[model samples]
Target: MEVSKRFEQAINKLYNAFHNDTLHPECCKQCAVGNILDGKDSWKHLSDNHGATTLNYLGQVHQNLGRTFNGYSPIELLHIEATFLKGCGYIIPLHHKNKRPKHVTDKDVLFLGLTAVVSYLCELDKRHDVMDCTTLFNYCNVIKQVSLLS
Candidate 1:
């Protein structure tokens, strides 16, 4: 799938953010969606409390796109959540207890970052009316394939 120029730009932005360590991992831990299933706060309260965070941005995207996990299959929701978490620097636990891999390859980070950017673009396109839906969806599909292949 050929990525549109805007999609490519989005991917670059996410890649640079990951490489520069600019993404807020600590903030994610306190995000509304991160704790959505935990029942610590009401959805409205959580959304109101977390201001200008990545999760907030994502929520806004969902609103604009009219897309949420409500109607999605459990596995699809998990994939979306996992992609969001991993993009926010949540490392997966290895087989060994209390052991985490010391390094994630740059390519892996790129894949994760691209996945995130494409996800956002998928929603953003709904509001902006700048990108072709077919092109964006195809690009997102390609990103998913690359992520899996990695």
Candidate 2:
């Protein structure tokens, strides 16, 4: 599938999941990273061993992009994204036992969209060696500033 279309599908899936109360932000975090590594949503696959595997997978992605992980593992990336969501005024429920916030905002949507795009690119690059991340990075940069209505 085209990257743009895949990204759109991911964003829509995430939106529906969030709106339907079927997925929490914490699970979404893992799903974002997992999708990139496993080519599908693997939120339920997170475990102690899976955490290490995710870090290794992200390292491989960075290598493929001619970049370095630079001490930032997938877990850290997830935390950073979660922090970004919090900064945008969304409450992040830290524990799975806690209920997710009832509201989502434009910022939340954009943040999740960017996450999906990044994850999708990681998976894409694994299959297509010549894929250029610059275009996707630019797309994400634009998304960061866009204001979409919930």
Q: Could you give candidate 2's per-residue lDDT for residues 1-150 as a string of tens digits?
A: 344454445446545544654443344433343332223333323322321224355444554565412223345444434443443344543444543444543446545544544454445434442235766578766676684532
100: Cα error in model 2, Å: 12
For each candidate, the alpha-carbon lDDT, in order, equals 0.42, 0.42
How big is the positional error of residue 105 in model 2, measured in Å on the Cα after superposition?
Answer: 13
Tens-digit lDDT string for candidate 1 (1-150): 455554455445445555655443223332213332232223332232322223355455565676644243223333434455456355531123332224433456445534663565555444343324657678888888999999
Q: How close is every model to the real structure, measured as TM-score?
A: 0.29, 0.31
True-vs-predicted CA distance for residue 23, candidate 2, Å: 2.4
lDDT of 2: 0.42
| Model 1 TM-score on a 0 to 1 scale | 0.29
Q: Give me candidate 2's TM-score against the actual structure.
A: 0.31
